[model samples]
Target: MSGGVDSSVTAALLAEQDFDLSAVFMRNWDTKDELGADGKCEWEKDWHDVQQVCKLLDIPCRMVDLSREYWLRVFEPALRVWERGMTPNPDVDCNREIKFDALVQRLGESAQWIATGHYAHLQWDDATHRAMLCRSVDRHKDQSYFLAAVQEPQLRRFMFPISHMTKPQLRELAHARGLPTASREDSVGICFVGQKRRFEQFISEYIPPSPGKIVDEHGKVIGEHNGLWKFTIGESSRVSGLKTRFYVAKKDAERNEIVAVPGRDHPMLQCRAVNTIDWRWVWPDHDVQQVLALQTKLGGRFTTKIRHAMAEIECTPSQGTSPENVVLSFAHPDAGVAPGQTAALYLNEWCLGCGTITETTCTADLQESASSEPT
Candidate 1:
């Protein structure tokens, strides 16, 4: 249950529904205690708190170590992409790998629906008999943005009990029910392999950062950068150069150079396109007509959340070239689309689905907008 308030309430609510429940905790290896100054992970106190909660509820709360699965399936692929100077979202993969893939295998008929404290909602669209992922009502606490990669069938098999409750409401529910996690602060931050900055350092250890030149749009070398892997498209993180803030315009992996613009107001740097939006099929191996029809059913002016903490932007998605994938165009343009990151799609604050940003065409020209640069 991750020793968090949302999850505690979820488990507690499930019990109230008269379902036999076991509070299974997923020990994700990526949570290596970045909050600590030293390298060692320090979530021991958190686990102890979870143990106390399980004891109080009289449910078997045990840890399922999914470290190897996490590394092999989730971290490795993301690490490789990061090493290549792209910024792919690993949490999307973590859900598919641990939540649906590994958790199903481990729980193995022990539970009917593998539930967690996630703030996203999953229910079968009765007409289509296909699972549809929707945004949680608690807009401030919704996490559908990170759940775009979850398959549709798995979405049907899951339940988010706290989908309708706000964080304050959840806290009140927990405190009233005497759940030990009632006061646990929200666990919202990055949890990749290694620590925060340590992850970058550890990656550089194995993936050597060949020195690259940091240049202006005019191709004048203003300063030196570690390597292309150390930067991402639209990244302004610690780049060396002119006085004002600048964003990465592009990363030339072949030339081992980085292109930067002096400020956010620059047209080229600001003209990032949110394209190649994809919606996954619940049953990819079966006839996809039902899935396509499901997408048609989801047609509406929904909302979109790009960054985790940002509020949802009103948007509408249309049927594109493929049945499984949908083309999403926002009511207005969005910024900070680092290549390889997910353009998470949603409707009514619910996550419809998301796809990796393989290409982001710009508005510079109609033809160029059809084919964007890779992250």
Candidate 2:
């Protein structure tokens, strides 16, 4: 359990259904590793809440130290990306490697299935004889994108009890049951990195600052940055130069430089096509020819979600530089397509798959087409 209303409600609902349940709180982070912790671990509060909930529900609760696994599987890879001056979504690796794979292998040997509080749905397909991931009824809170990397075998052994229920419904149920976390505020920011520290401060602990020059689109140096890792693709450049605010457009890792533009919708930040690395399909569509045929039959049409909780945007798919890559072309030139970010594909409400963005094709037409409106 996450010591949150969602997971607590999940356990309560499962208990009501007479299903045997045991709570395991995976301690994936140790505050002692942080330079600014001052010997305080924030997860203690979560642990206390978890134990209280378990006691109230009359169920067994245990803590598993997965800090080593998390560091190896999630942290190392992300650190490499950050060092290269690119943003990486650690949650994707956390869900795929730590939560669904390593955690299950460690603790779910005897259990018939594993359940979590993720807001996603699973449907058994008679035709394919497989479990397909679907969007939750609460579309506003759908988490299928984050679960896209979870393989079919692991998905088959998973369950989401609150798939059809909304967040308000979960809070209401928790209040009725007198759960201690009923009115507790939800956790925010990165999972292991508590919100108490700024995101840049936490990241800088792993990736030491490398001072570099900030340049405009024409290679003109406008300002200087403490580190390229401190800025993301779409964030506003705090460095002073122009009359209007400039948004971070790209990073030159070799030169240790950042590129900023005049507006948020600047064409330099817009791209018509993006290449995804290590693309994973939720179903059994692994054969390249089969995938191509399926795309051709569907006219390569799909609704793509670039980030969490964002509305689906129309796009077309094609083969990328290699078999492991998939190239997605947006219906319209899109801004803020960042390398190392997730690009999740969907068909209506059924989540197809997802992959990490590797590269994008920024064309003159795309750049010129960007809106010139001031923000």
Candidate 3:
């Protein structure tokens, strides 16, 4: 359960309903491993805390090692995009690689459905024999965007216990239930790759950081940047020799230089097409067909998100050449969308699966996927 309040409360709620549960913590990231020869680390502290929480709950807990799978499926892909100067979303990749893809395969003869602490909903239709991914009731904590790439069929066996629970209610219940993880703070930063500095350093070991040029919108030289991976579209920060603080407006992988704008005149970031949407399982027309046809029932005005926790901007989806390559046009303008961010398409409150953001009418990428819509 990761020894967090939300997960602790989730276990409590499920237990109260008389559901037999055996919780498993995925050891996807070994923070100590990331630390290398740097001696013991704080991540070990987190690991100890997770074990203690499992003990207090009196539930059987085991660690599932997904290190290799994660490396192959998520980290490598994310690294590829980042080196290419795209701001890829790792959270979305973790969902697909660990939650839906690996966990489902690992369940084997034991578990029926995979459960996580994510605030999202899963629905099944026996009549239509279909499964749907939906947004959580709590808008603030909704994680539908992170799960936009979830295939429709695999969702049939998925369960989200926190779908309707608010963050406050979950915390309060955790303490009342005397769950050991109740007091644990929400997790922040990278779980496997470590912190920003750590991940960047690790990446540099292999990718070989190349000093690049910083330029303005008109292709005028502005300053010098440390590395291409260090900057993302719409990111505001220091650039040596720049008179004013700048935001990354564009990145040219070919020249290994970033184009920055003095202010927020970043009208050049938007693009066309959201290619390669996928789900947990196949539904008819899932290939490249849904790109164009959303059955009349699925079509309409929906909020399409380029990243998580940001306000959902309005969009309308239409049939495309490929089901995976559907096109969505924004109803209003939104800004700062990076090339590798996942643009999740949602209907009402339901997460109708999602795809990697190959190219954007506005701009962005799928979570953590390079070939498949990563997010």
* Per-residue lDDT of candidate 3, residues 1-375 (tens digit): 665677666776776676677887766766457546566555456556667766776767777778778888988898898888887878888887777879778877588766678888877765776777777888888887877666665666777899888888888887887777777777665566554456676667667768888888778887888788887676774676667778887788899889887765545544334443432223444532453354455565566787776887777776556544555677766667666777776766666555555555433332224447544
Instruction: Kindly state the number of residue pairs that clash in model 3.
Output: 29
What order do you get sorting by lDDT, best first? 2, 3, 1
Worst 10 residues of 1 by lDDT: 282-291
Global lDDT of each candidate:
0.69, 0.84, 0.69
**CA shift at 366, candidate 1, in angstroms?**
5.7
Off by over 4 Å in 3: 41-43, 195-202, 240-244, 269-300, 361-375
Q: Candidate 1 vs candidate 2: which has greater TM-score?
A: 2
TM for every model, in the order presented, reads 0.83, 0.93, 0.86
RMSD of 2: 4.1
RMSD of each: 4.7, 4.1, 6.2
Better of 2 and 3 by lDDT: 2
Model 3 earns a TM-score of: 0.86
What overall lDDT, based on C-alpha atoms, would model 3 receive against the true structure?
0.69
Please provide, for model 2 over 1-375, each residue's C-alpha lDDT reduced to its tens digit, 9 standing for 90 to 100: 989888999889887876778889988987866455466587777888899999999989899888899989998989899888877888878999999988888985777888898999999977777998999988888889899888788899989999999888889999999999999987766786786779888888777779999999899999999988888887888877579999999988999999999887777777778889898888755534565566666564577888885767788777877767888888877777788888988766767788889887776555455655455
Best by lDDT: 2
CA lDDT, candidate 1, residue 56: 82
